[model samples]
Target: MERSVIHNLIAALPVAVVAVDHEARVSAANVAASALLGENLTDRPFVTVLRHPVVVQAVDAVLDPAHVSLPVPDPTLAAVGSGGYRNRVIISARGRDIPAEVTVSALPDRIGALVVIEDSSGIEEAEQQRRDFVANVSHELRTPLTAMIGFIETLRGPARDDAAARDRFLSIMETEAARMNRLVMDLLSLSRVESEERRRPAEAVDLTMIIGAVVATLTPHAEAHNVNISLIGAENEALVTGDPDQLTQVFHNLVENAVKYGGSGGEVRLELSRIRHEPALRGPAIAVAVIDRGEGIDEMHLPRLTERFYRVDNHRSRQQGGTGLGLAIVKHIIGRHRGRLRIESVKGQGSRFTVILPAKRDRR
Candidate 1:
């Protein structure tokens, strides 16, 4: 094959590819390889371009048939540090270390060898997120499970003959179990919302109706705390393209949070308005603000409010039956609708959580 044809073939591949000559010099490199190892890789010694010791060793072994059987570094151990026979290696490129899976194959007829590098940064990040998610879920579940087990043991033994103690322990166990259930439910909801975040909902939804339903649903709970929940603005139907159920969930979570955290005997207001432009939305949008009159969130905690299981007041949140995933769920739901969630708070005053959704343009 013509050299240009060969180079074009290599360039077409998604992974980085480089060919090394018998003298250990890079004879050919695809665009991806150049981009990965830096430009001007052609004719450079393979060792100089791939500085990782393990990667260099793997390439050298592939080039030299005699050392083909030489054991390569263990990939698991190689991942921990530089250099190894491992399939995964970290290569320094443009002052940044990139995680990549390396594959070395010897060419036919004692020719040079080919090295393919597949970037694995995204994979590693996703794996890390999975690990963290599992750990968080385990910790959340364990707390309640441990409490329930202890109560069970007490009920079965020490509190068997004590009706008052048994009753109290059972009540506590029930509460713990309920908490576990809520956490599981919230986790499921979060998973579903995240899975659908990239797909915009096409259904036309009325923000007014969604907010109204949410207020009606949470009114009793708000009344119990002497916190009045009121819906203001947008007398007409404020329509937006979204999923009604998810929109309902979005407002429910926000309004419920407002009522729960808003100070006792205070008012929680849900305000809606049509706007021509919102910086976050970048177009005409409908903005819904769930404002509360309770002790406001500190500025420091505002940025992390939408993070999963992040709580400003853990004890109070647990006491109030908060799953700690409410805002996280709301955030995801809003994102699915191509909307933005903005949090503004001031100490000792109140907080406002706003949702800005793009307005459906008139097709006329």
Candidate 2:
């Protein structure tokens, strides 16, 4: 392949590639580099454009020839840092605020420097998410487990001789056991939604039917909370093509949350409608909106509401028996359906969660 062809191939490989001259001016860039670092980097210095503190340090280290060795925190990003002629640095980029894995290599016979950038934001974010998940899961599980253990110990050691004491301990144990069961179920549901999201499942499901079923299931919970949960515009069927089980879970999560977290005795409404214009989709879309008359979400926290294990109020969420995975599961399910999830909230009024899915294609 010619030089342009080679550059094009590398650029097309999803790795951001930039070559800098001895004077630190951009010698060449691949398509990925231009797209990631911006389209205007042909004659600019790589450092001046990227401006990541970590990258600057790595490039300086590679060109110095005096620094014998330097460290790159991540082993995957260590390839460039280990070599004297080249050093790899993990840096956060401006505008996008994305962390990139970059490798800087000096050309043979001191020609110039080769810089390769890879956006590691997804991988790094996933790792951090895993750590947070483990910590959250551990803490969640420990609460009920500790309570059950203490109750059991009291019943077995002293309360064993007293019927009244034994009865009280058993009652407490039941509640703790129930709490544990709820946590495990939510965790399993979250895992199932995430695992199945990567592969698209084609099954024709009626939106009205799914909404009705979810409402029926949550009726008792709604009644207990003195709240009304009902499906609106259910007279006509709205069809959506996706996994029924996952979609049902999405509906259940949203409705159940309305009862649990929405304001006391407020109305929880579910509506199914169609949108002719949605920028995220190519054509007409099917939209499902769940409106709640509860204490709404803060505008600032709206963007991060879908993050796993994220809570608006940790103490209140735990007290209300929430696992904090409901919204995250809703997000993954919508993603599996190739849809968009939008949350609109007002501090004192309420919240409306909208899920927009592609309309089923017709065949003659």
Candidate 3:
């Protein structure tokens, strides 16, 4: 009933709230309202402070006795009846346009109308991310599915008359099916990694030993490509608290990528070094870098390497049987361990992929 009491009630609200008198002037505005709309909002004409036509109309409809003219039918305004007016609209704040929900309700005793504005930017962004992720997954699966379907039809019809043609088609079909399988596996892995990314792994493990085994396993593949994988700092021990399986996966993907992309240079080197103080990690750390001598990546493509499904050469990546989720997985795995992935490359000198993790304080 009292003017000061009404101001206190509006100010106590968590979200942005503005009250307009029957005369259409801003009678009271909370701190959040000033932060959203602008400073010095009190005593100003509500229409002048909130220039949006739809919002102004909504407020006016609640204060109808003031003789304020209502604009054309606005879809943004959900209701403008006796009880209240509700709206979802975009408002500009600090130079960026954001989704805002505004609801105007008439106050009892004709004190004024209360206007509430809520920012929905985060919800909108998260929803958009979900939609984009679904679209990407659908497209990735469909390409291999389409190819497999075509090959199956040929095998069932034209290729049925010839043994050689059938064998070739079946091989192509098998490859497509395998690609789909890898995509599915990678999707699941990415999901698991993301869900547990916030929890840091605490098991102590040896980086050198893990990389040594990875190198041994991938040696034959390197030999087939005539690329030598020389492991440096293998004799020295560097320990860290981490999930061995995830750490292994991180190195496996990095080393395999080097052997696949930079193997043309005839050498893929796994170099390990100690960082006394990794500024990013803010303490002592261990760094393992996978260096290649083949043609390097362009500077422009470096920044987005960890983004899910981002590929510098999509066709070549597919040919190499890459899921395009390797680096993304690597990024999250390292994050869970409170580490960092550094990528450095030159157009002609090849690229270096480094994994730096916090070192275990005491070695067993």
Using lDDT as the measure, the top candidate is: 3
**Cα-lDDT of candidate 2:** 0.77
Give per-model CA RMSD: 4.0, 4.4, 3.4
Model 2 — TM-score against the truth?
0.79
Which ranges in model 2 have alpha carbons more than 4 Å from their true place? 1-13, 20-26, 31-113
Query: Which clashing pairs does model 3 show?
Result: none
User: For residue 283, what is the lDDT in candidate 1?
Assistant: 85
Ranking by TM-score: 1, 3, 2
- State the C-alpha lDDT per candidate: 0.83, 0.77, 0.88
Score every model by TM-score: 0.86, 0.79, 0.85
Which ten residues in a row are the worst by lDDT in model 1? 76-85
Q: Where is model 3 poorest over a 10-residue stretch in terms of lDDT?
A: 65-74
Model 3 C-alpha lDDT per residue in residues 1-364, reported as the tens digit of each score: 6668889998888999988888889889999998888899889998887777788877777777466655556667666556587888888776789898989889886668998999999999999989988888898899988888888888888887899988888888888889889999999999999999999887889998999999999999999999999999879888999999988899989988999999999999998999899999999999999999999999999999998889999999999898889999999999999998899999999999989999889656
TM-score, predicted candidate 3 vs. hidden true structure: 0.85
lDDT by residue (tens digit), candidate 2, 7-104: 56456666888876666777678877877777878678767778865566556656565753455463443543344333334554546577665677
